[model samples]
Target: MSTICLYGSASGGIDRRHVELAATVGRLIGERGHDLVYGGGGTSVMGAAEAAARAAGARTTGVMPRALMEVELPPEGLGELVVTDDMRERKAEMDARADAFIVLPGGLGTLEELFEIWVARTIGLHTKPLAVLDLDGHYAGLRTWLEDLVARGFARPLAFEVVHWGADPATALDHLESAPRERISLPSSEILGSFADFPDDRRERP
Candidate 1:
């Protein structure tokens, strides 16, 4: 009965495997009787996932920024469609609605959403589980970099534990469902300082 938010590419021409994985994740969510929250795009991975979820009887919700309405194409027949003034508002709504998060292969937008949610969880903003499905090793480099941060003493051990990675959708969902419901309340400044040397340009301003 949890509301799971999925973050992924909205582009119409992403890799076929990624799209298929997204659809599979959606079907699984529906089969488990969980609701889905996602970006309200009617193209690419997002569209394929939502379509599958709806077909399987999952309650689907979509949040879209007004500016990207035309570009992303608002999906139809969702249980709910929330249109916000900007990207920040859209993300906020999604975060507030979701009980857990699952990230599929995507680009900058997807990365931004994942990092922000992870940071929020690390700082005790929420006690929800976060998972990344690494379809075709798409997140291999990112995982390595995160591990390096832990090894370098930049990020706390809890930071590494906040994200659960799986090679496929089923495994990721299993990890998420079995995760403990406890929020890590580390000092916000300390958590922020861990990424002090992270590249400024890589940070997205919402």
Candidate 2:
């Protein structure tokens, strides 16, 4: 019954193995009766995942920045579409809607989403579970780097342990479902400033 947010590549004409992996994840989400929210791109991993999820009877939502409308096309018949004023807003919307997060194989944009959410969780911004789908050793180097950070004392071991890594979709989902939500002792106002103090979503012009 949880709403899972998926982060992955939106580019077209990529490797077929990655595309199948995305589809498999989507199918499992549907079969497990979990809903889905994603970046709302209609190509490659993004599109394949949503399409498979919808086909398997999962309710799917797509969140996108209005600015990217010209650059990315959301799949047709997406259950719902939410347009945000900026990338930050889009991510915020997804964060609020999702109970868990799963990252598929992707490129730079995917990595950006992963680190932002991972850091936010480390700081107690949210306690939801997060995982990365490490298909065919795709994320082996990144995993090594994260471990190195912990070993070097650049990152806390607790923070590093929260990120569950799985080579397959089912194992990833299992970890997410079983992971406990962390309780933060920090005050809400201290962790998150007042809404009034938040900057406007629109970009400033010189």
Candidate 3:
């Protein structure tokens, strides 16, 4: 089984469409027998997604920064909860636990998580599906920008293709499970930097 990491807003303003889709994501993850791996925040997208997953009897795990936990408690229930020192630690822990990544409507923090995972995958740190739950063209502008980067030769075309987009949760998962996960060797390529050889869970702060 693979752990699917979802990146989304904890408190950003959300549209009703996004909220409904987020709940469906949790249900799908459970129904498909995939576990939910996400940030541990009870108030926002994280909470909504996990709640849906829990309702469907799917396993869920949370990786949280201790600073955030003092205020935004984790969802009421999760199969696993991990607390870390800082943002870096939180990201690393999520990376350590996830085999794939997904994104939903979110703000800066969500974008940050999405980019870090995108960077990690682009540099061959791990090979897994990175999907964008593209509800109501929520990511249309960013998608166009990324394509522009590739057309301008600022990024590899394949790297720009890292984001798989779909309008609904089922289609996203269909894309996610369509391919076999690829595992990269530590230091497999120099593109990202050292630590490729360190164990999958041992990346150092950059």
Candidate 4:
């Protein structure tokens, strides 16, 4: 019923498994009657997934920064193409529009966006579901690194609690769609605000 933010690489051209997973995410977004909000690039995995969703007749919203759009074309097929000032603004826009988040395989950019969402949840800016689409165990090393961080003193086990990971897009979407919506509290605001103070510290769990 609502939109889910999809975070992933706009590059890499997508391998077979990545493409299949992206397509599956798109199909589920459409079949479940939820809208798709994604990076508005016409190349790589971003295009593949958004195209899949659009082809299936889902209302697709593309959020892009002007810089990325200049580097990569804005997808022409979007139901709503929102051009933002920059990458941070683009993320903020998507954060406002999406009810939940689903991350696919991506590079630094993908990690960056998901980190922002996790921080938002931790600090109480939002309480929406956040999930990772771990296709082909692509995120295995990162997950391990997170565990290692938790073992150390740099992060909280509960901070990592913000994310739900899955290998299957169907189950991922199901969890996202079923997440209980809640109102924000002052305590949550302080938690999210702490991240702005601890930008360097959010990379791992304590």
Candidate 5:
């Protein structure tokens, strides 16, 4: 079974709808005969997803940073828990274990994870598929912003093309499973060309 890495909020302040959404994603993962890996938090969206996945018979693995043990304890009955020295290692562990990724509505930390994975995909670090559950237009703004970035040449169009956007869990998972892994070709000349036009100023900003 493929292991799906989930990224979402760990804060207790998120709306109930988001919690339910996370649970749905989890349930679908298990029902489809897949496994789960996520941040080892027992509260908020992270907890909800893990709980539902475990209940549905999916093997759940919680990868957490040791520093967050006190703040975000893992829930009881997790199939496995992998502790790391820091957040970077935690993310790396999760990335290594999962075959695909899905994102739920979240705050700063979630966005950081999403962007990092997307950047990694662009640079050929991994060819795994990723998606954002955009139920009820929650991620519509972010989608538009990303498109704008692509339009302005700040982001690669292919990078955006690889991300599957879905409004439901089952459909998103299906798309991710079927998503093709394409070889990325980004030469240094194309990437560094923008820097060539910049004025070299050795002065420090006030």
Candidate 6:
């Protein structure tokens, strides 16, 4: 069985629909007999998903940063929990463990994780399939911006081709299942040239 890593919010203030969506996705993952890997938190969207997946009989693993333990307490009953010294280590551990990735409604942190994985895929670092569940058009704006970047010559066609999107969990899972297990081969120049240019002073602003 594949181990699906889910990136999503850990905030209790998010919309109820998003919470329900997370739970449903988790349940579906379990029902499909796949394992789950996610941020280890006992509250909000991540917590809800973990809970549902475990209840449905899926093996659940959580990767968390040591520093966030107090704030994002590790949930009870995880089959495995890996705590890292920092966020980077936490992300690395999750990446090494997952066979595929799913993006759910979340905040900036989730977006960061998704982008990092997308870049890794573009560079042929891994062949795992990545998908975004665009529930209620949550990712519509981001998709438009990506396409616009390609149109403006800031990104290559491969950049957009690296990602897949679905309107619901089952569709997302199906896409992942059908994806090839071999890494995509791209010329080194294309990979190196895909990065968008940024002003040197951009980081100077706050």
Error at 4, model 3, angstroms: 0.9
What TM-score, computed on C-alpha atoms, does each candidate reach?
A: 0.88, 0.87, 0.84, 0.85, 0.90, 0.90
Candidates, ranked, TM-score: 5, 6, 1, 2, 4, 3
Candidate 3 wrong stretches, greater than 4 Å: 182-206
- Deviation of model 6 at 119, angstroms: 0.5
Q: What is the lDDT of residue 182 in candidate 3?
A: 68
TM-score of 1: 0.88
Q: Give Cα-based local distance difference scores for all models.
A: 0.89, 0.89, 0.81, 0.82, 0.90, 0.88
Question: Model 3 over residues 1-206: C-alpha lDDT tens digits?
Answer: 66788888777466777877888998899888888888987766778889888788778988998888866678776788998999999888888888778899998888898888887787777887788888888888988998899888677766766667788788888878886566544443545644467776566545
Residue 60, candidate 5: how far off, in angstroms? 0.5
Q: Give per-residue CA lDDT, model 4, range 169-193, as digits (tens).
A: 8888888988776644545554464
lDDT per residue as tens, model 5, 29-138: 99889999999998899999999999999999999888899898899999999999998898899999989999998889999999999898988888899999987888
Report how far off residue 40 is in candidate 4 (Å): 0.3
- Give every collision pair in model 2: none
Choose the strongest candidate by lDDT: 5
- For residues 1-206, write the lDDT of model 2, one tens digit per residue: 89999999999877899999999999999999999999999899999999999999999999999998777798889999999999999999998999999999999989999999998888878899999988888889988998899898677677767788877789899988889997545557644545556567633433
Cα displacement (Å) at residue 21, model 6: 0.7
Candidate 4, residue 117: the lDDT equals 89
Sequence-dependent TM-score of model 6: 0.90
What lDDT does model 6 reach?
0.88
